[model samples]
Target chain A: MQLAHHSRAGGSVLVWTMLVMVILSLLAVEVLRAVSGRFQVGVQAATWQEALLGAESGVDLAVVELRKSLYPAPNGAWQDWTTVPGNGVLSHGLTTVPNAGLAGSPMNIEVNVDAPAQLKDPATGWQYYRIRTLGSLPLSGPPRVSYNKEDNRLRKLTLLNQRFIDGLFTSETNDAHAARRIEAIIRPLGSFDQAIMSVGVLDLNNQNIVIDSYDSRDPLKSTNALYPYNDRNADGTLKRQENGNIATNGSILDAGGAHVYGDVSTNSGTATGVANVTGEQRTDFYQDPIPIGAPTWTSINPAPSTVTNNTTLTASATKGAASSRYVLRAIDLSGPQTLTLAGNANGSQTYIEIYVTGDISLTGNAQLTVAPGVSATIYFKGDVDIAGNGLVNTNNQPGDLLFYGIQPDTGQNPYVKLGGNGAITAAVYAPGHDVTVNGGGSDGHVFGSAVGKTVTMTGVTNLHYDEALSSGGLINNYKIVSWFEDTR
Target chain B: MKLQLKKSGGFALSEVMVSTAVFSAVSMGLLMGFTSLERNFTATADFATNHADEMRISDYLALDLRRALSVQAAQNDTTILIPAYYDNAGNPQTPALDGRGGVVYGAIGSSVRVRYYLSGSTIYRQQDSAAPITVAMNVKDFVFNVTDLGKVVTTRITFNPTFMAGGASAAATAATAFYNTTLLRNSRTDIASSVY
Candidate 1:
């Protein structure tokens, strides 16, 4: 019984030892499994992070390519990437070799450009454009991985167009109030001659007024009336009737409520009005005003009451209407006809009309003066070229001079030149071509109402205003006019 | 024969008593050693896991705090976007601003905003955006400080793990656990201070 008991007890002890060992082994296996599982999780997390970084790299590459294509080169021409020669690769060192999985997978990038079509020359087909690029990065990664994306960008550019209008208008004053109140209306007919279509009004003040009859109030209308206030039309004739009205489809009145049968202008302070009309008005008024039955003065052969050359013209002019209205006409001189006046004469407030059947030229220091309450009208069939220190003065408070031209009835190619330190306190009006005030020193002022189809300042010209002035077209002082072109 | 049998019986009884006493003593010693070892092992494992988790969360939060860009305040100025950091893809997250004001190193909290502050050795993280996660309790010392033009954000957290042995209370465990202070530093000095 003792031996049997000993054996049984030993066997039970052995079984208990075996059970402890098995339990220990199982626990070790479980611990090993847990550790391995955790390590595997760490590896998986790292791999995903790497994949995300790779995707980010692709985005960076696309941005670089976009910036490169948009920037201009040193040359005038812009870079073109549309017709990429081989494999559509832009030769700026941006390239990628195909990997094993994504090898030979052609990645095509397309750039959509939107810009002004007018910039492209119809003949050369060269144009400026703003480009938006979309690059596709095709990949052969695992099915679980996604690798496609899109981005957008914007750029601005300029191009050349054949139908661009190059013209400028400069204000002679710094007053914001004056600039806001003064309006220039320019109407051009036929070909647009920059030289003949500009009007310069120098004495701009707080109350200065410039009425532009040619400028169209509507911008969308492509007819002559389009862009009334903003652009110059091709006709070259800007008309403002007596009351300050522009004749378009009908009579377009000025802001001052004036009626103008033809183009009308006044000094800065003049309260002028215009008459309204509708539809295109008759262009007949602009025709040559020379009547066929008018008597022609062959010559001042007897030399009308001539005096010493030094005597100023104002001292000798007769006060009567017959003497004051004497015509010193010339038959033939040069292409520029000259009439030399030498006398000491004065006249009552009368009208002095100088009619030139052809181009008129005035030389030497000729002084012509009209007495108080007097008005003079100089008519020339051709251009008027005045040189030397010539003085043409109207002594009356509201004295005026109207220069009418014949031939070229279309209001083109007419020219007026004023040179030297000449002083003229008179209202001068012209309809066609241009008026140039040149050679006057900085101190002198030309006080007048100058209405020209286009007025340009050739040299240093000072315009002094005792009253008001207006113009029908553009006023350009050549040196500073180029900056206003819209390059976009 | 009877006398011999009686003497053997006494010897047998004495042997039984002696064996029982020895067995009892040995079993008690072995049991005590096993219990002690088990407690130590469990304490080590729990301390390791807790420390690791704390370090991981600290690192994650430190990264977010370092990359903070701007702090924006709500209408009341009581709540603000603190440590507002943008992700790699430029997606903005809250906590736009960070820094210390007086003894508190945090910004204002809104309904969906949070502020981090330190009091003594305990670090409290409060969020109005969501229910606050205690994050770490029984901390011996916790500090979030800035330096280097507000670019460097350094955090130090100290805790005790030995107190956790034998199912101890958090306070007790924290007091007795292995005391370790971890310093987590991140570079995001451009982050503006919280103005909220």
Candidate 2:
């Protein structure tokens, strides 16, 4: 009986020991699982961040492509990128996982652009583009057709065909964990965004000045976009489109009862004597980046400028064809020397680009004439003084002639003065020069826009802003006008 | 007769001793296993909390730097000066002209100075002279480095482990160091700006 009892006690002990071991093992497994899960969470966060960075890089690459091939013939091409069919307005580019992201693995970046939008009413001109990009990490979702065939069921293309359908959402990022998409609109910061923009004070000393706007592309606004003020507003104003606005980073002084038919803005301080102006006078304006470098004509279709007497440059081919360029050290015409420019009215317009390294002084009957169908732009490095017969645009279109001033990295303050009667119809941009229109109090009737470091009109001037310039003219550089991450 | 019955019922001394020894060993083993389970659970929970803090710090700092016009930090300490942007209902308000027509800092509902500094183990984000808002807790180490003229910001943050056993290795007690380097998209110069 004693031997039997001893064996039975050991048997019960074994059962108790087994129960304790099973419970302990379960707890240990739970702890291990929790630790593993946390570790994975950390990894997931890092991968998502890398995906975001990659997407940003991808968008930048797309911008480079757009610049490389800026649509329309002679300026650039759309070579390596895929141009969407139906209207060559869209382009797409992709970077696969082989291209290392911020972290090295399973990440892909993609970018697409809906570029150079046109007006729906079919007037003319094109600008402004929308871009969408995707950044993906550990892209082991559904497979995509463009992805690697060997990794069939591992990665997916998040967006395609210009429709990230769930677009226009908050920045609440839809694709950060595995995929993300962002969208941005781009445009150029040209002089045409406003009528008159100056880095310093904008002094309008003339009371008879008619600062108004007209759209050259819109027929309903003018007689073939020539500006007789076809539209009238209830406020008894001409072409009350009110787009003949003016802005300055400094202050506006001595407006002197000017009939400004547009908005006035002085971002720095106050706007004095602007009581007769016919628009809102605001003081909250941001400065534009007009720091564009000089043109490198040596590298781009170089042609020496050797004309000293009366000269005429005919149209090369037509619009969109390669425009001829001439780089001259200086353009100094004194007493009877004339420079004539002619274009074709038969849809084959002439386009010319001129770079003047030194001063451009025209005095005593010295004339620079630009005929119809001629579009010319002058990027000058030194002072520009137009007296005597001055500069004349027979086309009477502001878009036909453009003057952009180039400031050196370090030099004395330069000047762009227009005291000649012929230097009336044009657009002028000199970010660092004092652009003074010494009209001598004559019929200060001027056309187009002016952007300078300081703009002063001493005479009775009527400056008209061509609204068409806002759509296409004098584009120095492109910028992201609006950007957002489509959280949707 | 009674004495004989009692003697028969009693067990041998060796038998009792062997049973005592086995039970004592089993109890000791069970106790040690439970202690280990509790320790692991607590350690893992603390580690996860630290990781959550890392993610939070990165998100806030990166967003602020990307939109800020400038950033400043004195050293690799738990302090950093952010860009000129004001907080409006959890949103960053951009720089704008005040009624005085100039960009002055700390104007009401306008651009304000945002600074992040440490207080003991707690991190606070101070906007102007306003009351500081707590951001993180139990941070053991922090580094805020600004380079490339406020265009590049690098940050490293570490949290202290809650429990450390005796004779534990240095690595076992050391928590993860979360590091990140971000660029100011608004001011970075490496991007392509002008074509020619």
Candidate 3:
């Protein structure tokens, strides 16, 4: 019985051993299978990751393309998908899949791209665009990643005119015509006391202007007929007007006043002054201060026995035709005249007074030449024309010759020309006109005062002591002979 | 006594026969189980390894393709070339196989060339004077598709492996080879718009 029990136990032990071996083997195989499955999973995940990266790469490419198009070809449109050369294929041994699961799969892929939408309309404002990309991997083919993108761009816009009255009015309706018709009157009571009287009428296109002198000499004349008289005392105590002759009692008889009617033109001299109807007191009318011995009579045939202080000269006359040539010499005038200095001869030592008169034309090769070291004054009542190569040399001494004129109050800045190779050294006073020096050969030094106008020197080599006291003018293209002051 | 001895001996023989038959059946059953387990383990290992390799390959492909600037193809359309910039090196040689059985990769001019037969088993990548690097071995097939936009480029690559390790052969069979599709956008637009 013991022997039999031992054999059975041994047999049982052997069977147990065999069963354990089989279990161990099965466990090993299962572990190996699990490992293999994990490997396959890993490979799949890798492939998906690669595809994703590829998709990102595609998006980057699109960005680059968009940038290129927007900058290089601003006017060109952006569309379509493009392949980068050598990008489709992989490097040797870099991505080798031995015994891969899929067979005959297409590794190379074509990308279809949608049109890029505008992000912002420049005319409207901000805009945006949607970009979509698809990376298609065929069944049993190489994997591919599809890419999509959306972007935005900002747009900007650019005013053209900014001036007042650029095209408002024509040249004829400008301010030049309005100034000539208006005149202001001033009355003097004493040395400092002054008042405004009645205004006067003047031609808008008048070439000449004149200021009349007041007379105070005679007595026993009624002062009421003087029109706008300044009676400061108003106590019936009459005083003689400034720049006038009066008697000892200071009672006015002939209250001397001047009148300017229409536009005065003349060929000879005439006396024009205001007188009282009774003629008890005689007075002389004067605008400027008369010298103590002015109008000195030199060539008198028969000297008058007693010179009357009340007698005065203020009228003007014209000499010679516009076409005639005349040589002017030194002469004295007790009154005004319009002397035309024409001809091929030179004018020397000539003195003339022009109150209110017509135009003075200097035709031909006339030279209104004032000799040096001599004094001369030409007071023009009208426009002075120095045409046809005519020359006016005002340089007589350091400060000898003077050209004085009352410029019409027109707003137009009329020009005065020294046209030849002549030099002028004078204090020219034109209260309302601009002085222009034109001509290449002309040179002069002008020391003068011009109110309310510009002194332009064009094509001139030299000018001296020139002053302008207003605006709306320019001084250009000329050489200044000496220092000048401009008060504006 | 003699009768008892003869009977016992005969019974012993029968017992031995029965035990042998039983042992043989048990052994066969254990052997079959172990064999099945071994096969499963092997399949798992293969799958894990192949998956890792696939991941590595896919990553490499994506990175290289990302650097692609342009693409060129041979006249026959079987060979493709890719020009790419790598790091600060500016230009680097990178050739890939098309999975065909032909000579499909080399460096030509300034581009990397890739060539393979449509029925090739391995994808070969070659550069000038450089030994070819096999990108995908035991590959069943490979294909490439390239798309063109006027200013942009897209390249797609697909490949299949030959060996399938696990019962996941069905999944493997349906599985597509790793592929990278890249779009190369034009870089001139930004520069063109800059006035300076």
Candidate 4:
């Protein structure tokens, strides 16, 4: 009986020991697996971040291709980009990073650009585009370690059963790839890129000349989007904003004490009195060529209207209506001849293109008034002399009144002269003419932009450039207005 | 009956010695296994802690560099200076014009300056006149390469080991440096202007 009991006890001890050993071994395996899993999670987080950066690179590539279209090209080629048949979008096929020849890029990026959408100012034909991009990095490939000494990249962490390269970490067994999708909107930047652009010498030759800017689209900058600005400070005081810029291709000289509330730049030309410029004063600047050409008139129905002294000449056109044209003869106003330009009587936004064949010589207090709701562009072929009360813009919208000097095929010298006390709210575009802005004490406000071959300003002419015009001109450059990621 | 009892006592003595030896061997094996597991767990925890610290610093610096208006050399103990262009909730401080056409741009670019500095192994961040607070610890070296003209800022950090017993960690580093480059946003072109 004693022998039997001893053998039974011994057998029980052996069985219990085996069971405990098995349980302990399982726990060890589970702990190691948990540790490996934690390491893998860290790798995934880093790889996803890298994928996002690649997606942004795709967007930048799309912007470069779109900008190329701005220049004259064959069929507006976007560098071999194909069109999406359904949406007409230009798609850049999936391409590996680092271009070709460069090694160690394990990512791919693709770009797409949609067709242009016309802007509000249909006359300019300005447009914006939508761009989409896709960036992805596959982790299913064999894991790689070791830094590329040739590329001078930092050495990756020697992870256990993992891979890390170029700031991206991944597991050797990871089969799924991460992707990032981004969409951005590219739009034409503001029109009047600057307050003034001169092809020749721009002389601010007077001390009392003031250069400032104000935005008419903002109610705080202008009263009801007009003049008599709304006090943006809520302090019941009108202040000039420091964005009234000026630039010239030739020398900018003799700016004697003229407080330019904006920037001044020139291409290999000196700018005098830079101390007076509140904004940046720079040289060696570059600008696009300003070409002021007359538009080809359609000569459609509703014959061109003629303006007479003491009469209201009406210029009318509705949305989607055929553009209208007007004829104004070059005549010297001998007395107090007042010509009123009125919009459509039906309360429609009307725009007209006027053709002036002769010189406009205003003497004494002879004034040409621009009524409300009228947008006019006077294409003059001769010299303009506004010596009287100047162009009286009752609407006070600078963009509403534009003077386009047409390059005459063969004619007399081209010049535009403004010498009156009345505040002129108009943009003058004559790249080949000598623009002279004289007279006007503190009450003389020239609220517009000027692009002349040579602009000479004197007296106390307060050139209050309309900041809103910056949004008007043709698309000078491209800008990303809005960008976001598509999480889906 | 006397002979059988004597034989039983002698056999019990031998069995006790053998059983004690076996129990001791098993206990020692188990103890060794547990000690090794504890060491590995500690080594992994140290490595993870170090990696997390490095990631945190890289992410935080990238964010700060992207939003900074300017990156100047630490003057009088200040390492970096960022403007208050964003509020506490990460929303832009928009400057609005009043109904009277006047704009008070205090909200757009405020006078509040977010500053950073390093003291020994700790990095402290202070906003304007506020007291400095510790942002990071155990830093061996921190360097900033600022290209003002390019509007780019590159930051590199060197960290000390959390546990020196891991035989050179796979993730954390003491000799190798981790760096990040960030392009700035909302830069004031007038202050430090660059031409393309």
**Which structure among the candidates has the greatest TM-score?**
4
How far does residue A427 in candidate 1 sit from its true spot (Å)? 54
Please write out the lDDT profile of model 2 over residues A314-388, one tens digit for every residue: 555544334467677888777788887767667356787778888888888888888777888888888998885
Name model 3 segments beyond 4 Å from true.
Answer: A1-488, B1-57, B72-120, B140-172, B175-196
Question: A-chain TM-score per prediction?
Answer: 0.30, 0.64, 0.23, 0.64
Number of the predicted model whose DockQ against the real structure is largest: 4
Model 1 misplaced regions, further than 4 Å: A1-10, A22-488, B1-18, B70-114, B117-130, B133-149, B163-196
Q: Order of all candidates by lDDT, from best down to worst?
A: 2, 4, 1, 3
lDDT, model 3, position B177: 43
Q: Tell me how large the interface RMSD of candidate 1 is.
A: 25.3
Per-model TM-score versus the true fold = 0.29, 0.49, 0.26, 0.56
Please write out the lDDT profile of model 3 over residues A270-325, one tens digit for every residue: 21233221221222221211101112223322211221122122111222122111
Candidates 2 and 4 compared: the better one by TM-score is 4
lDDT string, candidate 1, B1-196, tens digits: 9998787667566888999999999999989987887777666655654554345334334423422332231211112233322233443222212111111012333112445444443344455455444444444433323222232334333344564435455565344332222221222223422211
Question: Clashing residue pairs in candidate 2, if any?
Answer: A69-A77, A175-A179, A175-A180, A391-A422, A391-A423, A444-A461
lDDT of 4 at A444: 73
Ranking by DockQ: 4, 2, 3, 1
Whole-model lDDT per candidate: 0.34, 0.62, 0.30, 0.61
Q: Answer with 3 or 4, whichever has the higher TM-score.
A: 4
Q: State the DockQ of every prediction.
A: 0.01, 0.03, 0.02, 0.05
Q: Tens-digit lDDT track for model 4 on A1-488?
A: 98999999999999999998988888878777666555554554456566667778877777666555544334254656665312344565455765321124377777766744322234344555666676666543334432212111111222242231322211222345555565565656543656777878888875567788887776666667655432554786574577787888776644566889888888878888666788877686665543445555566324334444565656666522344565666645647887667786654677766677767777787877777778876778789888857588866788888887776555556899987785778888777688888657667778888877788886756788887776664444566544444432
Is 1 or 3 the stronger prediction by lDDT?
1
